[model samples]
Target: MSATPSRYCHLIDEGEVFLERCRRILGEIQAAEDDLSAMTTSPRGRLRVGLAFAAGLPLPVISAFMERYPEIQLDLDFTDRMVDVIDEGFDVVIRGSELKDSRLMSRPLGPYRSCLVASPVYLQNRGIPAKPADLLTHSCLHYRWQNSGKLYQWPFKKQQAIQAGESLPVTMVCSNVEALIYLAQAGRGIACVPDFAVKDSLADGRLDKVLTNSLIGGSTFHVVWPSSRQMAPKVRAFVDFAVENFSKGLVS
Candidate 1:
């Protein structure tokens, strides 16, 4: 082959880059076509999902989803810490906190409220807390936030005197809401938790509400996914299913 002049050497490098870019574009087009075909045929793919630790308590939703979509494989990650939907490659994430990321598209699952609860035995032994101030004297089962490493503040609507920095009489601290519920049921201490989590215990006479008039905390859950021009079929199916089921008083 004839030796290329120095002036034309840069063109060779640019040509190589142009060819690489063309290959990349073709690969992307093929992937997009595959996605479209899958959508039109059936929602079948590996779906990576992240759920808040407490959100996993609704086993029926998970069970029903799996039963309905046997072709789709589910990869679930349960954690209390915030997960990045894009960076972590999660197709969907269900969380009890407010949606702050503008890059995510979200659908409201439902609202859930936190309340003070203790075992019937515990209430008998320590006496029912008639007011929010009474918690200072009672053994409190505290939930420490996984992300911030701080205790969850029990929101008492009537007790403005209870400052944020004020310490409660903490007996046991856990990051998992289910553990705290179990501890409360075992008559360890009074716990503040979401109402949906302790529904069975309350129905079975294992736990009872405390300070119902004063203590109040609630938040809506959201199903979030990365924003895109078009959502994958599997992701869309899960999001719609969650919204439909959860809206029927599942979380509330």
Candidate 2:
């Protein structure tokens, strides 16, 4: 005899629940397999990392990491844009901004300070900025934010009050920090940049610090990854390596 209509509906509901249970069981089994594999084998897989543009820490860290783990291959993406860790399939992302996503985990690498820098020629020709207000008259190389398309603010300590529509004189604008550094080194204009990126230049006298006592923009770099029940071996290794290397005050 044929089942009643309500009985058919009940069967469909039961089947749906059964499929869901099966899917969940399969997921658990896969997770267990992954954990077992990770435990048994060394970190030897492709690791995708997202890095901020022109952050000085990547070169040394990447070189050291590859030397230490020769089996693991690295895929690096460098950009100033904010990346989605999980959705973008990045195993790790290093950024100078604070973490906002609750689904991700972060480890602080170190702090970096920003300062206004210019070539000696530029300073001599344009005159050194005695204070933050003097920047209004000097040619400024500005950094345009990749995500917001707005100019990066020159965070100066004890900033003076400005008139209704006063702003720094912008001679050029670019999104890449390295480009700004290059231009500043070429005697183009004064550019605000992370101090670590110009350490050698400052030491060799290729660039001179401007408004040294007034600029106060700095932030800590963080290595971020997706939150998981068991962190992958490759991700764990890199995180530990980064923390150890950066703890030595290498990045300034």
Candidate 3:
């Protein structure tokens, strides 16, 4: 049968369109397979993590992870500085990130409760603070943020709004929370550090919690990673493990 010239051209155009669609579908299929493999397959690579100095709480669990994946190596950076995860080449950062960037992915660990604590000796010598307002007369160990150049104030319960009338000044200050805890333990002053940081001391009577009614609202920790079309297997593995175990009770 002799086909009209227009009909023949239309048939050829349709065939071309169908072939292009097939190519696109195949490409999508391949991408899906790659993503599946990335998640299901055993990952072997180095993971660089930036964290707060209080990594000890969650880090203990990482020892088990290492035993499971002997091929994966870890590089840790324990500093309070707000790390540039993407520019600094950190595979992941576990910190109290604000999570404002749209170009990043995050998983919340959990909220931390700030505690007003002092060594037993400090309390014995200085006398325990009867109320949040009493902190004005007592010495305070301050936390100075390196990135912001701001001293953290002791956050008290909103119910005691009168007690938290203003941010009190500190006599002693440092950038390290651990240092502040150590100084507090040495009876230098009462330190307002993350509850996670002082759990052991509080349990063993090294540190005593004062002003129990006026607890500070601490920030939530998150596992943040750079957003990409193809997430690395190593990054996924660590993020999942952290969210499952380190997200809660590491401090509680």
Candidate 4:
């Protein structure tokens, strides 16, 4: 029996209807995918960070960033000992000075100055040393790097030349910055440390700056992360926020 033309027309109409439904479903799927992509790229995750104790100046920067990106969870590990950010599983790291590592990318957050300081009680008890050479006579607090085999040398400026040869008479040597700073605050001995760490104490008369004109060396604070983290939304947001706040001197 020959097929009717109406039957053929009906089959063609049904095929058209099926194609139209498929196109509609595909459009809906595409729209759903776009929505998912937007959400996936959004900054929302727990961000682990590492920072030196001396780099606490960036706390306000973190606070400001949190205000803008409420979805990111922040975990800050503040310590003086260095850690491999990538290997240690840290998303970001705030270092007190420029990093020389070729594996990581860093942004200049700001510069900081270190000062030789002592408590007034200690200085009063032991006369203030007028020169870097005189620090040899004074009981000086020494900061030891766990990674560096040697004790930190007291770097000083003399005349037009940078002199780092003058090693202080070390009465105390410790790895913890907080402990050493506390001892300095308690009038144990003279200490050379970041100015920001003792800014409050210096202002409140608990600590006094010694050899204000001489500094170890000027170093810039940096926000460092693994180069692989560039595309991470949380890391990107944090880095941008840190640069904005720190560079403007708004946070620190």
Number of the top TM-score candidate: 3
Ranking by lDDT: 2, 1, 3, 4
Residue-wise C-alpha lDDT for candidate 4, range 22-45, written one tens digit per residue: 999999898777656644797889
By TM-score, highest first, what's the ranking?
3, 2, 1, 4
Q: Give one digit per residue, the lDDT tens place, for model 1 in 93-145.
A: 99887668889999888888898899999899889877676778899999998
Leading candidate by lDDT: 2
TM values, all candidates:
0.80, 0.81, 0.85, 0.72
- For model 2, residues 137-221, the per-residue Cα lDDT tens digits are 8889999999889999888774553344788888999998889999999999999998888888899999999777786658888
Give the 10-residue window scoring lowest on summed lDDT in candidate 3: 160-169
* Model 3 error, position 90 (Å): 1.4
Model 3 regions lying over 4 Å from their true place: 1-20, 158-167, 247-249
> Which window of 10 residues has the lowest lDDT sum in candidate 4?
158-167
Structure candidate 3, residue pairs in collision: none
In candidate 4, stretches whose alpha carbon ends up further than 4 angstroms from where it belongs are 1-40, 158-167, 228-230, 247-252
Give candidate 2 regions above 4 Å deviation: 1-40, 161-164, 247-251
Model 3 error, position 132 (Å): 2.3
* lDDT to native, each model: 0.84, 0.86, 0.82, 0.78
Worst 10 residues of 2 by lDDT: 156-165
TM-score of 1: 0.80
